[model samples]
Target: MESSDLRNAGLKVTLPRIKILEMLENSDARHLSAEDIYRRLIEMNEDVGLATVYRVLTQFEAAGLVRRHNFEGGHAVFELERGPHHDHMVCLDSGKVIEFVSEEIEEIQQRIAAKHGYDVEEHSLVLYVRPKNRVAGKVGKG
Candidate 1:
């Protein structure tokens, strides 16, 4: 079924491509760079190379099966574009990422775009932040 989806999207149905697509679709870590995907493949004992991961991800992005995000980091991260739209919040301290959606924020963006005499084609909002209040023994960002 996944291979058919890939074929429909103009991609060759291959083992590495199918495995990478599965990882992107099913991972708890929705946003991942090519390096991250490569690490995951290695962890799974798959022989897919890092260069293959990068190439497959780029192909997926071009085919609109995935979306690439360039957060504050120099590297780019890719996410499967198969769900509702949402923005991201990144914790600077721990490199944690959170996804959120706000109707009010969306309205504000639309209004701003209208005011500027341009239809909003797309928008990406990433808020880089840290904890407001620190709790003892709390070292993780949520």
Candidate 2:
């Protein structure tokens, strides 16, 4: 992928880099684990190794091309960094990850920081939740 985004990130455009970037951007699943990416590559008949996927994803994270989430599990999931910031809601039952943004939450964070006489530079909030009915436990995001 000969992308200006790649060049600006100070990364050389290679097949692996291009394919990985494309996969992240085009995939319907907003977040993906490295194994998910590797499996997709194999399904597409792309000759990308799992190790190479890890390496490329790490490089992208370093370059600010993607953001990694260490949600409850030790495994990390990655999403392309398209500029807006949002928090996550993880479904404890199904292990689903949902992305959401709330103006109220954002304001509350800033207010809390100011009350402490400290400016907010950055923060991450993850809400671990299960279905209200628990019986259904089908995680979903609106």
Candidate 3:
């Protein structure tokens, strides 16, 4: 988001906020933690601090500009909320996050919720996974 977008979100257009927003929008990796953003900012010679990163991220989340996922066994990661609905698959071994959408899964979820007499308002699905050929209980790279 640009400075105007930040203004539109009701957040003041400050340097840290602008830097963090630009970083989030331009990064190759869609998901990032506060530490991740801080490290990258350091690498880019930007003066944004970790605390500022966290604060900006929190503000962005509150303003509906980003989404945070607290995956199992990991610090929270943030991704920009500018996409169609999709589910996530978090790798148990590599900690990689993959996004996918399945109509069948959606339909089943809708059917189940309907049968229970409740309409699905919102939902988040995250499947923890390992490599398909990996044996059970495998720890890490061989």
Using TM-score as the measure, the top candidate is 3
Clashing pairs in 1: none
Per-model TM against the reference: 0.89, 0.91, 0.92
Query: Which pairs of residues collide in candidate 3?
Result: none
lDDT (Cα, tens digit) per residue for candidate 1, span 56-106 = 999999998999998886489999987689999998778778999999999
Residues 24-75, candidate 3: write the lDDT tens digits: 8999988899999999999999987788899899999999999999999999
What does each candidate score in C-alpha RMSD?
4.9, 5.5, 3.2
Give a tens-digit lDDT track for model 2, residues 24-126.
9899998999999999999999999999999999999999989999998649999998788899999988898888999999999999999999898999999
In model 3, where is the ten-residue run with the lowest total lDDT? 133-142
lDDT of each: 0.90, 0.91, 0.92
| 1 or 2, greater by lDDT | 2
lDDT of 3 at 92: 95
Point out where model 1 deviates above 4 Å: 135-142
Q: How does residue 37 of candidate 1 score in lDDT? A: 92
